[model samples]
Every structure is written in C-alpha cells, then in structure tokens.
Target: MMRYILVGILALMVLAVGLLSFEWYRGQNQAVAFGAPFELVDDSGQPITEKAFQGRPTALFFGFTHCPDVCPTTLFEMEGWLDELGEEGEDLQAFFITVDPERDTPEVMKTYLGNFSDRVTGITGDPEKVAAMAKAFRIYSRKVELEDGDYTMDHTASVMLLDRNGDFFGTISYEENAETAVAKLRRLINEG
Candidate 1:
C-alpha cells in the first residue's frame, strides 16, 4: 500500500512539473508587442509617434502615392470596409504611411489622401525616418526607374491590422475578397 502511495505521489509531482513547464514555455514564446518606435509626420505636418497606433485598433498600409493600381485600390477598399463597419468601427483608425518619402511630402500626402475616407490619415516624413519605420514594420519598398526618367515604387500591398494595444493581429491583402476583408475588420474591431 505504501509503495502504491509513493508511486502515486511521484506521478502527481511529475504531472505538476510538466504543467508548469508548459506554461513557462508558452509565456516565453508568446509575442512581445509589435512594431518599433517611430517619429514621423501626419498629413497635416503634425508630429506623430507610435502612440497613434495605440488607444485604438489600427489598419496600417505602406505604399507610395504614385502607385498606379495597388495603392489606390487598397485605399478605396479600406474606405469601403470602414463604411461597411460604420458605427461598429468607430473605434478603429486607419493610416497610410508613405514608402516614397522623397516624393511624398506632407502636403502631397494630404492631397493624395483626400480622395479616401477622412478617417484614414496619411503619414510621411524624412526619407530616412520613413525607411526606418518601414523596416520596423517589415514593409518592403524599392524604387524602379522608368524609361522617362521618372520612377515608381514596388512595395508590399498588405494592410497590417493592429489591436488596440498595438500588437500585431493580422493583415488585409491587396484586393482581398470584400466579404472576407470586411469580416476581418469586424473581427479586429470586435475582438481587438
């Protein structure tokens, strides 16, 4: 009987240790917040920081105003998603960060973003600052020279979804299905 009790106690101790180890491993592996600190300017030339990404859920897109298709299309769809969500998404905020800061000044961003939802704010700044911000967010952008001595940017076309706490949540790919995209936004607002 004593032997059985000792074995039982040993089993219980092993199980306890296993459970604790699992919890500890999970805590270690869980993501530590998202995004790096940044100092940039909004369309109105206001100093904006990573703090803008907090306090409310954020939909952040990285693209250049000169993008021929993806940028405008994504912005239009983002506006629609916001409109579709309506009051439900009142707590949500959207941002457009320029990857081509050399050509996209604050004034230019203001004019370019005018065609999108007023809820969407444009972010641009010094080229180096913008590049650093893009790198921190894992956004890829490169300039491609055209035959006419002009240039265009090749950039990531996904919109990053961040929770109110500014943690990485998910993304909305360019030209994502409207229903699926709206559903993702709704989920972000409702759960994030």
Candidate 2:
C-alpha cells in the first residue's frame, strides 16, 4: 500500500510539471506573436514595410503634427534619448505615425519630424490604413475640435519599442524621463 501511494504522488508531480511547462511555452509564443505586419508611406513617399524595420530596434509613436503640446513634448523627449545614446542611437530608428492622416501629408510629416531629428522618420497613409495600423498597435487617437477652424488630436502618449525582429518588445510611458527611456531601449537592443 505504501508503494502504491509513492507511485501516485510521482505521477501527480509529473503532471504538474507538464502543465507548468505548457503554460510557459504558451506565454512565450504569445510574446513572439505580439506585432503584426504594416505598410505605409514614409516621409519621402516611399513604401515602408515591417521588413524595413527588421534587424533593428524601432521606437514607434502615434500622433499628429497639429498636436498642441503632448506631441512636441514626446518628440523632444525622443531627441534627448537619441542624444543620450550617441552613436548607438543610429542603430535605433524612430517612427512617427500620424493618426490624423487627413492632414498629415508626407510633406507635413517630413517637416514635423525635421524639428526633432533627421534620424526620425515620419509615416502617413490612407485614413483607413492608418486607423487599421493604430488599432493593431492598440493606439487611441481622436480628433477634438476647438473654437478655431483647426482641431487637435488627443492620443495616448506612449512610445512602443519593437525588437530587432519586429516583435513588440514593450513600451515606455510618456511620463518616463529621457534617461529612463534610453536605458530601457538600450536593454531591449542588447537583449535582442
């Protein structure tokens, strides 16, 4: 009877271990599947694809040029991060995707990004395409009208970090300091 009890306990332990291993594997697979493919026109009106970002860490943000405050602040933070990274910053690419595609034409994108850094790239596309991409990235952006004929966009102010293989590594909140963001980005690049 003692021998039977020992055998049952061993079987239960093995089952538990198997279940834990399966769960871990599932979690890893989900992480690997984080990002989806997207296509848009770059500042120069050239077609850009997920393949373009492959083998390089990418920092992605969604905003419009018409943004009054948050957008410029975020871009300035990114510039500071690049300065912190120095030469290593070249290895990382920054993409600014405009949520207000109706107004953010390729020319506008180019000019807006130029204020931050030449290293920064701007992307805009058809409204439907931009909306779909924003949905995929879980970005929230909405247009808010003001007394003036112009409008402003209210968007989530988080920067997304994509791994070298174009997987969604993680994000840095807008509230984070430039130093903190740079450290996180460097760690992501090194790990990848």
Q: RMSD per prediction, one decimal?
A: 2.6, 2.7
lDDT of 2 at 140: 93
Shift in Å, residue 23, candidate 1 = 6.0
lDDT of each: 0.92, 0.87
Give, for candidate 2, the lowest lDDT window spanning 10 residues. 31-40
- Once all C-alphas are superposed, what RMSD does model 1 give against the true structure? 2.6
Off by more than 4 A, model 1: 1-29
TM-score of each: 0.86, 0.86
lDDT score for candidate 1 against the true structure: 0.92
- lDDT digits (tens) for residues 44-154 of candidate 2: 999987787689998999999988788899899888888888887678989999999999999999998989889889989999988888888889988888897778888
Count of backbone collisions within predicted model 2: 0
Q: Residue 102 lDDT in model 2?
A: 97
List of clashing residue pairs for candidate 2: none
